[model samples]
Target: MPQIPSAEALRHARAALATETETIAKAGGRAPVTDPVITPFVRALRAGGFTIQTSASGCDALGTCPACQNRYLYTALRAGLAHAVCPHCRDAADRKAAVAGAARASAGPCPPDRVGWRGAAIAAPPA
Candidate 1:
């Protein structure tokens, strides 16, 4: 049988999690919790399946990556974003985008007929 944490321990963990959440919110998604006194409690709650709800504007929080299902810290700038990816996954996405962009650029310009109205306007010969 597994040992269960006491009520006092759970309360302390909750408080620690709240404090860290506030710190991250105040820092605008730039600060990570490094307080020696609080980190362990927060980590414990997280490992025990506690979830912290972040603000809609933005926040830095520890979260599980939806894509990889691995726990990681993620920062979101807005509400619409899926803020679950780790740094490694984000870097990989950026690299992939860069490669695709390079491929498109090297594929040469689209034929004149294939160009949209905006493209045609830009490419039109001077009147």
Candidate 2:
């Protein structure tokens, strides 16, 4: 089980949740909140390979629990919500993954006409 989230962490989560909720509502979509609901927007979480624990209120005001980062409403009557990110250093990890991925892709397999010059294939080592 994960520990409770810090106030700062919760603040970050709340901001992110609001951004996503507004974006969804603006699109005229009634997205029922769920653990899977954030899958699309949690790219940072995904890239960092962090597992999230959502609460039963996943479909509520999109509020996030400080303990589990679960989404839920302030109350049954408030439209506002609270959220927090997983404490997995997902942001930094994701950035590293992105940079590493770009480096890997750019250094992909050599062309058919090239030959091994170390890990890199060159022009058949100039014959």
Candidate 3:
């Protein structure tokens, strides 16, 4: 049988949920308190000392980028993105991903003879 939470533990859990709900309300509800994508991103921003200000309708926000210290506006409708992210940082990340992808492509596919070996261990010889 599974152990049930004690009465006191249940009460504490309820209180915590209530507090979280209130916080979400104040933040304009752009993302829920438990949102998989936005919640952790917002938490990381706050931890990095960035302030996020949201509109009353919960569709827009303004925040500063900790990486570049540039202010950026976030709108869910603008680019089909659901979360607020600094454009500069986003661009940097995109460039980094592109470079990594290019590097991987340049490395080429594994030889058919190395089918049993892992990809990392089957690096193509330099041209």
Candidate 4:
């Protein structure tokens, strides 16, 4: 489980990021990452043995979570649903399936009908 950041920690990080962003805008360059507030905040948390890690990439980064609106939703390749969903939503769907019993193969194309006799055999006189 990931450790949730405290309000204070979030505030500090936001301030640091804003300060750095403003500085970069003034300098006409991308933001420099040497914000002083960041180091102190991280060090304070480290002293308490709390690790701060951000969600980097994967499906979470590619799409937004439908439930939380966070970029934590990932693309899931399930049988029926052809959409991206968060892990929680996927589990809920699984539970629903179990309760509903196995799905019948009724949606896909129907199998071909068995071949039938074209017509009654015609008797022919000796050639």
Give candidate 4's root-mean-square deviation (CA, Å).
21.0
Give stretches of model 2 more than 4 Å off. 1-3, 34-127
Say which candidate scores most in lDDT.
1
Candidate 4: global Cα-lDDT?
0.34
Lowest summed lDDT across 10 adjacent residues in model 2 is found at 73-82
Give me candidate 2's TM-score against the actual structure.
0.27
Give the per-residue lDDT of model 3 (tens digit) for 1-127. 1112223443454555567878888988853436433344444443333333333342324556557787652311111112335534542111111111221221234232221101122234567
**Whole-model lDDT, model 3:** 0.35
Error of 4 at 53 (Å): 7.6
- TM-score on alpha carbons, each prediction: 0.24, 0.27, 0.24, 0.30
Order the candidate numbers by lDDT, best to worst. Answer: 1, 3, 4, 2
The better-scoring model by TM-score among 2 and 4 is 4
Give me the displacement of residue 53 in model 3, in angstroms: 3.1
Candidate 2: tens digits of C-alpha lDDT, residues 31-120: 557443343334333333332322223321233345555443111100111123333321111111111121122123422332121112
- Model 1: colliding residue pairs: none
Model 1 ranges off by over 4 Å: 1-3, 30-42, 45-127
Q: What TM-score quantifies how close candidate 3 is to the native fold?
A: 0.24
Tens digits of per-residue lDDT for model 1 on 1-127? 1222234654676677678778888988855646443354445434544322232222334455556675653322112212222432432111111111211211234222222211121233445
lDDT of 4 by residue, 26-89 (tens): 9899765653533444433434333222112211123455566655343222232222334333
In candidate 3, which residue pairs get closer than 3 Å at backbone N, Cα or C atoms, i.e. clash? none
